[model samples]
Target: MIYKSMLLVILLLPMIGSLVGWLIGRKSEKYRDKFNILLTAAELLIISLMFKRIGVEPVSLFIPDIMGTGLALKLDIFRYIFVWVTAFIWFLTTIYSTQYLIRYKNRNRYYAFFMLTLGSTIGIFLSENLINLFTFFEIMSFTSYLLVIHDEDEYAHDAGKSYISMAIIGGLVLLMGLFLMYDYLGTVDISVLSHSMKNIGSIKYLISTLLIIGFGVKASIVPLHVWLPKAHPAAPTPASAVLSGILVKTGIFGIIIVVGVIMNGDIPLSTAVIILGFINMLLGGFLAIFQRNVKRILAYSSMSQVGYIMVGLGLIGLLKDHNAIAVYATLYHIFNHALFKVLLFLCAGIIYMILHELSINAIRGFGKHKNVLKVLFLIGLFAIIGMPGFNGFISKTLLHEALSEAHHMYKTRWFDVAELVFTISSSFTVAYLLKIFITVFMEESEEYRGQYRDHLKKRAIVPMIMLSVVIIFIGLRPNVILKVLEGTMELFHAHGSIEPHFYDIKNIKSSIITIGYGCIIYFGFIRSYLRRRENGRPIYFNPSLRWLSLERHIYIPVGRFLYRSSSVVFKVIDRGIINLVIYLSNSLKSLSGIKVKRPTRVIADLKIKKPKELTRFKIKEEHEDITKRLSKRSMHKEFVTFMDMVTVLRRNLNSLMYAVFILAVMIIVVLGVLVF
Candidate 1:
């Protein structure tokens, strides 16, 4: 009771206190900021106190039937650690945003939504059942939408449109999945479902697909990641930090719940996830290199990082014996990615605010005189690039080793290829980071050097410095967090026997190899031709747009087509059937009443004239839509050939289909032999 009470207070405080921030902001901005900072600080303190009470077993709170479902909340070791992370991050972002948002309007609205988002995110981590998780998930989504569109410009509005579209579609699909799953199981209890739903037949596949789409949109894996790049650049700096830093992680958290628990770590499911992860990783890394906008690069990078985490989730499912190590890697990377990615975005925010520009070309040499921001940015850069002594190094190393172990256990060529792709993506990562560094920091632009000035103050950088310090500290002393992770690993019954050799010779050598490849790519591509040609010349590398944007090529067109097609089909089937029934009934009544004139010929019957009013209305409001006619044409220009795309999809889909078909055939053959 004591633990539950304390836990409840920590979870609910930020949201409830948001009212105070809102009310205060309406009356006085200063008081609102102070109140928000105090609320975050107090929430952190309370969470720490609550953390002290959580043991091996979880502390639980149960509410009787409400909202068509029961509310179940628990504070286990994992939840406690995540809650602690949430409070800590919320506090830091609050402090950072205070300085970041000083010049922006709606300071009060931003602060209010900020706290509301914070509370809902914490609530997600604390939730013990699906209903509880989704309730908070929705609140987090809607409140965060406000944050995304805080700027209220056309760009913000468009980005908000993209963001909300994905969110609503995902949420509705996820809701249907939840309803189906709960109807089948009669409950949304996490513990019971993970343990019992081992074989729900083919419907499990449908449920799984729904859940993945629901969560993957936010996770931004491959075809579903259209909104991230646009939304990140459109949002305010502080909101951008939170969006990349923590908001995406909520989608990831839902994914973990679905894949890890609901699906029971099925091998086929895991394999499918790995393939998607690898695709996103490659595509995101490939796309980031082409981007000039600093925030868009980071947004794409976030997509790839989520890919890394997804890979770990897949491995955990595949290697149940070592689920602990895999789960630990996944959780650890989520934390590190949040840290460095948020820091990177915050750095961008400060740069944008200081110079009133986001284009790397425009901000060239801005970091030359700003040593502190430069160093902090480098720390974040290195952390993300998996440099030897930053936080990302630890998580990346663990995942690489886990992948190696899984490869050893199953020595297939596909695993070998997957490892190769993962390795090269790391190289691509280095190439892009070098591009950002060289363009903004190293390369000199005389035009912008004179125009640009350092405007970020000391207080604005407090968050960056703090994050950098923590990242560096964790890189050096990973055991500090690894110890907590190992405990959480125990709950999953995963193999987490840590050894010194992990960070020793082999992994060190591996890290050196990755960096060496990165170095080669940087000089070979980024430095070799692109920079060599850019000395007071009109030379720019053309980033081919044909395959660069999945959203444009696939997600948007396909999504709109499906939406329109489904609407058309529903209208035709439903309304057409009703209208036909009405016409037939009226004709039958006319015949039965003996009131019909001599029967008209078939041609005459079919040629009934339109109403005079309808004909006049149609002619008066005539419209022409060239684009609609264009859609009737071939979808692709010569460059965007349809057969080419179909061929590629067929190739990839064939491999997956072959695997499933073979697996099914094996099951069938075995069943036949057994029955005979």
Candidate 2:
């Protein structure tokens, strides 16, 4: 109970602080900023304590009969690692948001949603059962949507809509998959089922696929990844950090829990996981290489990183005791990726804030303006590129070890495919990350350099420096991370005594190989750079072409065709309604055709009663005078002109009122919504 209380407090503190900060923000910016800092500190402290506690003893807390979840929470080895990562990244993002959100006017609202997302994300990691995980997962989605649409621009709105729509669909599918799992397995606990039951047969595979797709939306797997580029660029920079750095991992976490824990080691399932992961790796990398927008390019790079994690995880599923090694690799990559990705994003934000531009072309000589940032970004670059000392090297090496060690377990053909894809992805990753580095620091653009140089602030330097240290620390002594990884790796059955040559921990040979290849690539890039420099402008390559993009070729076209089809259907429906109205009016006219003749007998009676003798010539002269007066007046023509004038004025007045009412309503609604 004490542990549970502490865990819950750790999760909810940020949320409480965010709300309090939002309320106070209206009164004082000083107080608001202080609240944010305080909340962040508290979160850091709590997470540190959690790490200590989990390190001492693994704890599991279960609350039965809550939301049909039989609410279960655990501080297991796996979650402990994930929680540590989440807390670290969350803290950095909070610090980043302090400055990032300041650019916007109503910053309180942004901070509120930001903290809300943090709370929900924490809950997701802490939840023991699938049901509770889903609940928090949904809360994270909806609140994160608010962050995505924070800019209130048309593009942001559209992206938010797409993101939510896809998320909801994914959530529903996830729920269905979970319910099915529960019906068959009688529980949705993270622990693997002890024995295979009759109820969970072939359907287990189907449900697993559905669940993967559901989580894959957030994971930003290819074909379902349209929202990632749109959402990240639209979000505030700090929010973008969390979205890429942490949020996507929740999807991966879902996959980890479901496939790794629940499925209890199915070979075919693992194979499928590997195949999809390989595809995502290649697809995400190639697509990222083409993007000119800084954040969007980073966003695509995130998908590629996700792909790396997936490949490691899927490989874990394939081998018996090797899943532990894969998990270790996944964890290492997760940590390394978070550090570098956040650094890059925060650096991008600082650049944008200082320069007010988002294009890479605009930041050509960025390295010259902010030398500190250049150094920081370079550290991130090295880490991401799997330099010998960086954290990325540790994970990639482990992954390579897992593959090579499990060579005997996996089929030769598929194993070769995975290896080839991994190698190619690494090459492509180097190309893009270096391309970004070169574009910003090495390129020659005097115009952007001049404009952005003056806006660099000391306030932004701290976060960058902090992240830079982390990247360097992890890079230099990967053993520091490997020690942490071994704790969790002990849970898997890594039984094969086949100590492959790849597991050789000798640094000198690997360093020589890496340096040799890097020199070659560097020279090749320089030659290419010289050629482009001489030619005036560099040629832009499309990465999406290399990996078949469903967005351009399939999704967009299918959407267009659907829109056109819907429009035609709507037109047909409208025409039908118009025709029905016309028919109804005609029917009414036909029904009222009966007419009555009036007063003929009354006129004759009146004439007979007034039977006095009259002169015919006098009567005829009077009738002629009356007929002449009527002819001169032209009553029909006057009536027609008056009716036309009234009709025009009536239509103009109706339209004018409609326009006024619409404008007034919009004004009120906008005020009410934004202010509220």
Candidate 3:
């Protein structure tokens, strides 16, 4: 009974506190900040009290009258991990935000949504019912949208537009899946659905895809990730920290529930996830390499790191009975990523607070003399790049082992290629991180040297210090987390043990190779091409700026096309009805030898200008054609030169289609073999 009450309190405290904090701030802002910090700390303490219950019988509270489908909350080792981390990060960022936002406007409003977002995020982790999960999921989305646009600038508004738009669409899609799930199974309870999915037939694929996409939007999987880069830079720093650290995990949490819990590791679904994971891994890291904004780079890094987590999730399915390592990798990476990624963002926050700028060129050498900030930043950097003796190394090494285990078990060439991609993506992680470190910290600049030496106080620095300590502790003693992760396996019904030899020579060698690749890429390609002399000073440029944007080119154009198509259909229908009316009127008038007066004016009243509309469609069609030609030419210039051997294949349309057909056939064969 006591535990159940605490569960309710844990879920509702932040939400209630959000309102209370806002009310209190109406009279006093200082009290509001302290209240929020204390509220978050209390949240952490409450969740910590439940840690002793791990591996014991899970605790659940069900309220049947809420949200029309009841509110179901559960506490198990799996959910506990996320809830505790969310509390811990939120508490620290709350403290950090107090100082970070001191000079910014609308402190009270920020705190309200900040705490509100925390509540909803915690709610997501605790939801045992799919509907309950989504209810909180949408709330989190809307609340965090406020956080993203807290600055209320044009950039923030634009980011907010993209963020909210994708979120609403993702939610609606997710709701559709839930609707289908309930219609078919008569329940949206996860536990019930887990058992019911096996009997769901082929329709299960459609349900899972909808759910994955709904969750994938938040997970920032490729093509669904356009909002993330913009949102991070536009949001306040503390918001950015949690956005990358905790919020994205909510999406991953849902996916894990769908894949690991409900579907029970369906092979086809797992294979598709692995493919997307690899795409996210490579594409995010590649884009991060060319970014100029620190937050944007970190945003892409978050996407890439989420990819690593996704790959781990997919491997859990591939490894089957021996999936313990992959499970550990997935869960442990979630924990580690939240720590280091948040730490890096907080460090970036400090830099931003000092200079009000995040461009690498503008802030270069600002950390040269700031030893405390530099060291804190390096800890995050080392951890992210998978340096030996860091938390990232532990989880990344486990991910590598999981991939290797899959390769060994199947002996497939596909796994071999995945392993190669995994190694290369790891190198990209190192390269982009080092790019930030060297350019912003190591490189000397006359303009930024000796600036803002003592701008940060204990309030700001302590949170980062705490995060760094946890990161190092976890890195050194990974088994501590691994042991806790072991408790989660029963939830997934996974058996066997994860006994990763963290310091094994093979693992160390893998880390060294990845790091070496990163160093080579950074010093060789990035240094030579990305930076140039401008006005006798070095400037970094983002070549990806010219690259095709998923939002600008794909999503917007498709939306316009749909809108135009619908408009044309409606206009034609209206014109047909009007012409019928005109014909009848003319027949009546002809009987009296008096034509309808001002017939052209009547037609014009409908506002369906045929010539103008036709011209508009023609112009749009021509524009699209030109855009496609430009995109193809850019692609040719950028990549075709590197693949001279494929020149003939590129030019021959028939040959390209043949290659695609063969690839499709190969994939079908692979899937068939895996399924059978």
Candidate 4:
């Protein structure tokens, strides 16, 4: 019963906070701060209860009768993992937001949207069916779109528009996939279909593809990730924290549910996911190395980190051996990614608020402004790079273990390529993160010093402190993350037999060697390659550099061709449209002026030879109408005179009476009030 109540509270708490925030936040600006505190306390308490109940007992709750739609909410172990990550980050962001959003206007509106997005995110986590998940996913997408475009700048608006367009398409594709899935399987419940014992056709592969592409757009996979860097940087700090830290995880959550729960461990589909993850891992890392902006680099890094999570999911789904370890590592990395990613984004926000600088080069010596923040930033960086004794190292090691186990089992060339690619990607991550650490912290000069001296604040330290402690705690004792994830992975029971040799220590040692080689490549090849000056100075490439040759070669010709083509097309279409509109207007005028009767024939019949005679004839016609009316009765004579006195009113009354009679007869006939 307590667990049931907790589910209700979890669903309703954000909505209540949203209402309370709107009701009171606008009248007093200070009320916005109060709303944050109040809502955070309430939310934290509810989430604490949920964790306690679920962590201790691990119960599942279902309500099948919702709105008579056969919908249900589940609090299973898998959902709980997402719930924990979202809840912890949301709490920290709330504390951070209380101080962060104070300087901005329209505090009330911002908080309201913030609360709405929280509710939507919680809905996504709690949804038990694909339809419900898609519904909540869209809500998460659009509500966050508002937050992204909140600054009302041209860049923000353009980014917001692109985000919505891509998100809507992704949602529609996901819906199509869900419909096809339900049509084939006859159910949308994730748990039911996973164990349903049905023969799936080729459409299953199509479903997997659609779902991956649908979710990959938000997960920031290559080619589909164009909007992420633009959207994250345009949004406010807290929103960016959740967007990077939690929102993208929803896509991973969706993939896991579809593949892990619905497909019942389809290895072929799993192989495809693994390949996509491989691509994401490499492309995300490669692109991140080229970025110069601080948040943009982190944004790209997010794509890469999510790539790691995808790797774990893909491998878990693929390998028959060590499947449990794969899922455990996936979920563990998911939590760690959220914790450290948000820490860095929030810390960057703090720096921005203080220095108002976003470029890495612009904040050359930000380390001098606040020593504590500098340390926190370094810790967050280390966490991301998988430095020893950080949370990232543990999960990454498990991922490598899983990949190694899968490689030996498959022994295919593709597996070898994936292993090599994964190792190389990890090496690049080390090089780029070291570059970030050095550029931000160690490199300093008179020009780089004291650029951000005025923006330091105690309020910014709260979230950093909380996140730093959590990262340290998890890093030192990774068993905490692994144990929780282990509890979650037991639900997916693989049926294949496994040999003890699959888990051999020799293979583990071999993978570690690859990792060592990766590190050496980072230090030896990439580090030296990047550090050496091209022309007696360190080198950087401009984004516009690729256009130089094109500018000299093809730009003028392409521009002239485009101009000529557009001019031709516009002229032709413009003439046709103009002619069409003119013809239409002339036809309307002619129709309006047209008369059925011939006025000349009437005048000839009247035989009016002169102007005075024509006037006399007009008077006679009117008198004739009066005489005909008077011939009916003495009362008719009085009515004719009254009509003559108010001619316009008489005409209007006759038209209105005719309309009313028609309407009355139609209504009566329909209702049988009067018979024909």
Best by TM-score: 3
Give the runs in model 1 whose Cα sits over 4 Å from its true position.
Answer: 446-454, 529-542, 546-548, 559-676
lDDT for each residue of candidate 4 in 284-349, tens digit (9 for 90 to 100): 776666666677778878888888888888777777645877877788889899989999898888
Tens digits of per-residue lDDT for model 2 on 286-329?
A: 67766778898889889888988877777776777646667677
RMSD per model, one decimal? 13.0, 13.6, 14.6, 12.8
TM-score of every model versus the real structure: 0.84, 0.78, 0.86, 0.76
Tell me the deviation in Å of residue 440 in model 2.
1.2
List the lowest-lDDT window of 10 residues for candidate 3. 639-648
- At residue 161, candidate 1 shows an lDDT of 91
Query: Can you write out model 1's per-residue Cα lDDT over 582-675, one digit (the tens) per residue?
Result: 3444455445533223222111111122222222123212111212232343323322222222223333443454455444444443222222
lDDT of 3 by residue, 182-222 (tens): 88899999998889998979999889988998899999987
In model 1, where is the ten-residue run with the lowest total lDDT? 601-610
Residue 351 shift from truth in candidate 2, angstroms: 0.9
| Candidate 4 Cα outliers beyond 4 Å, as residue runs | 56-70, 447-454, 494-539, 543-676
lDDT by candidate, in order shown: 0.76, 0.70, 0.85, 0.69
Clashes of 2: 3
